[model samples]
Target: MSQFVCVRLIQGNGLDLTLFQFDYDLTFAAFFLNADRTLYGRYGTRSSLKEAEADMSLAGFRDALAAALKLHAGYPGNREALAGKQAHEPRFKVPEEYPALREFKLKLDYEKKEFNGCIHCHQVRDAERRLLRERNEPLSDRDMFPWPIPDLVGLALDPEKRATVKSIADGSPAARAGFRTGDDLVSLSGQALVSTADVQWVLHNANDGAKLPVRVKRDDREATLMLELPTGWRRAADVSWRPTSWDLRRMATGGLVLENLTDDERHEAGVADDKLALRVKYVGQFGAHAAGRDAGFQKGDIVIEYDGVSKRLTESGLFAHATQVRKLRDRIPITVLRKGERVKLTLPMQ
Candidate 1:
């Protein structure tokens, strides 16, 4: 039972606010009270109520919340009438004795976490895990984050190429293993890696937190890089995230698309040889959407410029921006170059 709260505010008439604007200030505070009315967890923004001013309007913001609550708790037929309309509302009722259930109910009572928020699932899972831990329970190997990180296949060839460097996502165990770009992988233990599948196969059989022998080919020689594997590799497959519409929007739009500019098109557009004759990959899926469709962008479009700035797709931060920023569908605004022309559009995550 996790709780979720969404606070939407309509700024004063003159306030400059857009859907694209990222709000980091508005904090929802949940003050749980015990049977004796004693204060409990003050879950909300990262600060106290007094410290959260200027950036937030607690009262005006809370008014809508109070109204909604009053409707649900006091107004006649409000709950029944709105039940089908509120898709995100919690569906289950909780009993009083369960502490986790109680905490979850308390949070929801204040609208801290959403009924379907990540915190909600985590809270429920946390509660169950806590009960298990209290009873000295143990979880199986498949109940953890997947690990036994592997080097990208073909890493041995042109290992110095930054373009080919393996992606080491943040918080991954490989990050803890000191596995960095340009550190050519030679082998596991004493065996040489012939393909990416080889590394994957080795990891498939490996267990959690197990230290394995690693040999990295660096500067034309082989060197062993000792590292430990993280636990719960099997559990990785079972994990799933309930992406917000914003998350879906970001995923749909962010990714690189490059197409080759034909010789006739290049001449017609007066594009230079330096700008043409090669496929261009840019941030977000440019040619893959309705806005970008049939605009001469395809699997191979040569990009000349982006937003009047001459730069590579990787250099422009479009790819990273698309993947990193989970923006609401309303705020997406960006333009990219395709075949010497600039095309701007909002991306909808598929």
Candidate 2:
């Protein structure tokens, strides 16, 4: 810590998007950069909603810091290798630039002793999606699912080490690429790897069906492997656990946060395993988020059919279908199971 100057930014009220671009969904994110603004790498990763902190540790932080210092020592000689780490030009430069966040000022009003309100990191992602909704632009798989965790490709990383493979799933891209459990990821594509977040950065920028070359250390020897992704790989990701999923609810399910019914519950509800069995877990209140409630949806309602479609679908899949198929202001008919009886309902597409 003594070797570096630390600046902790608590708010994204006036965040300079052109300079500080990373995964906005993260609760905590850090950047390692040179004085001239050359990016070394990023630190921070979350893959679970129940235990988001389980994937990070002080040891991993120390490993990433040491790696950054090593990169810093190499300096200009490694600058070309760091070029891919920089962010691309964004549609909205800053948080406030998004249409949904236009009501906000550049900074927060801090007249109060404890300081006033400010934009939370998750709000930035929410605002981006809301702006697209306002523009009537359907969200692509890339937009809905950003910064895919390594596990989606069948790679589970050891948090205590810098990009060390913990496990590989059978028949996955990582396994097909010859990634072993004990292998240490040295680099992805051409960028040097420092943390799991760095691997995510490379995957984030990758196009469908792209071939990513990886350098790895296995059994005290260096090896090169190629990871080939099929088209629509991002579609395999599940985004229902994301914090921005609330905004997705506002746009897709009329502010209803739905959950898949358990097998027992499905049997009791007379829903077959292959039938729609989403239960309305939470209904949003106020503004656009209140659409479901306004449309006569109850929290305990079991959604057996949505938008005239009735098949087994996760909440995440339903979100994708709703946003892409339905237009703004269009109401879709739905059927729910209430007290062992069927009830008809309408869900507005906001």
Candidate 3:
């Protein structure tokens, strides 16, 4: 803890807008920087909500800190190489700047009562989505899925070792790139890789189907390889396990958790095997999330069609349709089968 000048920011009190810039979805994160806040690199990443440290580790953190110090010693000599490591200009400078967050009492001063009216990290992501909804703009897939993990490209990196290749999926892009187990990633694209988050940043900025250059060290020898990404690679990532998925649920399904109907259930319902039939696993009972309940939707209902269309089968697909194709507050006609009776219902898109 005493290796460097460490400032613990517990409750977002007097948070520096410039220094604290990052994706709000992060549970725990750190910025290794010089006194002037020239970012050496970032040190936290997450792929699942249940496991906050799924993509980070203490060992990796130490390695990143040491790398930051190395960069610090080099300073202006390596300044050009580090320029792309910094964050881009944000849509809103501060958390309170968003209209949805403006009403909440927030502490602008950190020293005194740092916990007072502190805005939680998750709220920032929620607020950003709210702003887009208010502006009548559809949330792009990139906005919905941010900071995609390297696993999306078929590499399961060692969380304990900084940028070490642990396992590669068969026939995955990484395998196609000739990446073998035990190879330590030196850099990704053009950015120096101190931790997994740094790799994620490079992947996040890459265009779909872009061929990225990767440098790795194997048995004391360094080699450069080409990683060719195919179309729709980002869809391999799952967002249902994220904390922000609850908000997506409300916006897309009106507070209903849905699951794909089994083959037997589809047979009994007389629906085609290829048809879209999602069974209601659970329905929210109270508050804003209970819009499904308020709209007369009940547990055990099987949704066969949404907005007179029977194309989307999976919950994620339905969510994409609702949020991307439909506008906020739009009334969608949903057809469901309840207790051997076909029922027609209208659900208001939140």
**Top of the candidates by lDDT:** 2
TM-score of 2: 0.94
Q: Tens digit of lDDT per residue, candidate 2, span 67-94?
A: 9999999999998889899878887788
Candidate number achieving the greatest TM-score relative to the actual structure: 2
For every model shown, the clashing-pair count is: 17, 0, 0
Pitting candidate 2 against candidate 3, the one with the higher lDDT is 2
Ranking by lDDT: 2, 3, 1
Every model: Cα RMSD to truth: 23.2, 1.9, 2.7
lDDT of 1 by residue, 2-105 (tens): 23243342321111111111112223323222233222112222112345332224442343233334433443443343222221222223222235455322
Model 1: lowest-lDDT 10 consecutive positions: 14-23
In model 1, the Cα lDDT at residue 9 comes to 29
Could you give me the TM-score of model 3 versus the true structure? 0.88
Candidate 3 residue pairs that clash: none
Worst 10 contiguous positions by lDDT, candidate 2:
108-117
* lDDT score of residue 306 within candidate 2: 88
